[model samples]
Target: MQFEPGDRRRVLPRHLRPAPAPEVFAYAIRPARPADLPHVREIYNHFVSNSAVTLDERRSTIPSWREKYALLDRLGLPFLVAVSPSGAVLGYAVAQPWAGKNAYRYTVEDSIYLGPGAGGKGLGSALLQALIEACEQRGIREMVAVISDRGAEASIRLHEKLGFVEAGRMGRVGHKFGRDLGTVYLRRALRPSRPRRGALFGRSR
Candidate 1:
């Protein structure tokens, strides 16, 4: 059987880690609507045009990206955009179900894309934090990040600071831009679904 674009072939993993306070973002977090696809497209295309954040070297079109958003949204996953108060989309982030297997429902892999200006600021963290919260609300157990090993120091560091730990690294699993590349997997567990007392939610029930 052939899997669809967002379909996975394995089961989700179990994650049982503590939850933290509301993540601080220099920008605001909001769900990505269909209208936001253009901004999302631009942000992602920048990475494809200039970075190794994704193995997909080809520039993605708005329709293709919208399809991804629709799939994840249908799965109850969060596809968010971090925008400036003036409404400029700085970055985007979301998690996709890890595997198609029933047991893998709780395990999801994460992805993030940001414009050049969005880096060095708190945009990525803000987006990640929101995604984490969204996952926890849906009873998601584990979130994984598969990052390319080339020039990804900031991404690796951000995940580390966000409570994810290095799980595994596969060497030379990808070849992009005419060079062999490695990728690393990082994971964080979100348990109990509820935020702590006096936390961002203000006295968790």
Candidate 2:
């Protein structure tokens, strides 16, 4: 008797089972909420304590993250996260004022980090792109990313792929893990999400 298409007993051989499709990585990108701070801190502090990707030697705490969350909200800057279906924060990216001065109001610096096993799965790119779009919508002009020179080549390439241009580099700016580390600065000019309704210096005729 021919096996019916719905037959479950006919276990296909390992090679013959119409090769099971690759499992898809699933996550959603969205603005970070206050509750996500703990997870965000965990992701960043991992790099801080175990790697040279971040220059900070101090581990990030939930309190500090809360303060940051509040500051970003007050400034209307974007702090985004990628969360798994179960609501776990998988990664995060945030933009802060490039400098405290009023002259720097239109520019911002970005920080991004992924939780363990979250990299190489397109999460970094997705988070960065979403952050860029959010900034553009808020009328921000420029974005800067200062990435570590050690063990961060992937981050640099990801930024470049998203239209960031190398602005500059500084060698030996930081010493961590018994070695001097440097940073590569990349900059991207952001366009408004939508054009102004009127022509420059004049209204449409």
Candidate 3:
């Protein structure tokens, strides 16, 4: 995909524009790198400071963010980012093990975050679809998304578009900023992959 300079959020960085332009908004979903932390954190902090997308209000530093990637990498989890032709990060997506038991090994929890300017575009869906592909490649069978109340509609709509169904809704489960937030669980079952021969190692596996 190719994005014109004016179409993307920020000035395209030289390294990020690895391709030519296309008719649609030019953006690509790629494996996230440690060097992309700053741009990723900027978008994430926007959600943290201004919205209930995340329960955390504390700001994230590069070190803390890197720690998260390290943990995910160690667990063979998926962490991806959406970047424009100019290198601006438009969004990020990830999946984490859903539970600690062996029975839960095939299930994973997923999340998607888009930068402020990237909303309303196909970016969110692209990020999610990429995450879904990553999970499918890794043999993940079920994926769950716990969405904040305010994001329920958009999240549900996206998940539905990707074949997810509403699993449950928990009322007043989390309090952030100054209001109570409801959590909605959306799930999608993926095709099975090669079975593991033995138990996997990890606290959340």
TM-score of 2: 0.87
Ranking of candidates on TM-score, top first: 2, 1, 3
What's the distance in Å from true for residue 37, model 2?
0.7
| Candidate 2 global CA lDDT score | 0.85
- Candidate 2 lDDT, 79-131, residue by residue in tens: 88888877888888899999789999999999999999888877888888888
> lDDT scores for all predictions?
0.80, 0.85, 0.80
Strongest candidate by lDDT: 2
- How well is each residue in 84-103 modelled by candidate 1, as lDDT tens digits? 66677777888898978978
Best by the TM-score measure = 2
Answer with 1 or 2, whichever has the higher TM-score: 2
lDDT of candidate 3 vs native? 0.80
Candidate 3 similarity to native, TM-score: 0.78
Q: What TM-score goes with each of the models?
A: 0.80, 0.87, 0.78
TM-score of model number 1: 0.80
